[model samples]
Target: MTIFIQSFGYQLWNIITNGPEIPTKLVDGQRILNMNNEFTDHEYKLLQLNAKAKHFIFSNVDRIMVTYEGTNQVKDTKINRLVHDYELFTMLENENISSMYAHFNDIINALKGLGKVVTPRFR
Candidate 1:
């Protein structure tokens, strides 16, 4: 009985020492949100852009055109990648979120620089 108790105690100690693995996505999100001014700024911008992306993806929007703001529309093909990335980002709840957020922000920024309103559609 003493031997069995010692083994059980060791097992319990091991369990206490090694906790369950946390998903990387949660860690990345926490890291970005917890960082300094630059990331804070990105977080703010991301919130707005995320909202726009969500609406664009869910709504009846078709394509983005830069005619009024600039010259050419965001090509349909490129938009597919953006949409795909956004959808995957939204659907997944892991470490991919941080990377996806960065990529999505990049695309949004590029579109905005061209004077396009990112409804995910700019005409």
Candidate 2:
């Protein structure tokens, strides 16, 4: 599992550096927003890719925490460490929930590309 997670991390880094296109959908209501600063095509693409990568990383970390094993071999201390890492990542990456939702679409696409076999636990 550690090896698999490392591989996923590497793939995610690649997706971040190389611009990946994520399809967008229109949401109901809300005001129409505009970008105040102009961006080149390449810069726009990079922004999209980074958004997607960040989204996937956040969601996956959450899922991993939800289903983390705390058995004999996997001690409670280990689980706590993993959860702490996830919380730290979330705090460092996301400023607010609104911005997180804004990038949801791109994150979904990135997850889809990663095979979409996440194990999420229900509370």
Candidate 3:
């Protein structure tokens, strides 16, 4: 129980501070202001590569893109794993208001059977 609270608190802190930007996308780059007002050639190239790699990975990750029915436009979105987990927690809560450990175990086992990690309890 203590470990669970500690884990929840840590995740909550991350959500408050970093929010979603873990494997930061290209747009997640912060502008630089060097004292010399310029990036070294190597630094510039590294920045370019970072943007390219992030964009490639972002474009390729499945389920990372969401759209409404009968839509052809792709919208810009940030994928936050923590937020998704929180949503799952809400869903499970709605499913089992009794909040019994047995019910929790059933939920976790179902997910495990389907190759998903068990959703932890959090408020």
How does model 2 fare in lDDT?
0.53
Candidate 3: C-alpha lDDT: 0.44
Q: What TM-score number comes out for model 3?
A: 0.24
Clash pairs (backbone) in predicted model 2? none
Per-candidate clashes, comma-separated: 2, 0, 0
- Per-residue C-alpha lDDT of model 2 across residues 8-110, encoded as one tens digit per residue: 6655567655655443433586434335364567657666666767886677786656556434334545445444443333422635777765455444444
Off by over 4 Å in 1: 1-95, 120-123
TM per candidate comes to 0.24, 0.29, 0.24
Best by lDDT: 2
Q: Where does the lowest 10-residue lDDT sum fall in candidate 3?
A: 69-78
Q: In candidate 1, residue 44 scores what lDDT?
A: 56
Question: What's the CA error at residue 107 for candidate 3, in Å?
Answer: 15
Show where candidate 2 strays beyond 4 Å: 1-11, 14-36, 67-73, 76-123
CA shift at 27, candidate 1, in angstroms? 75
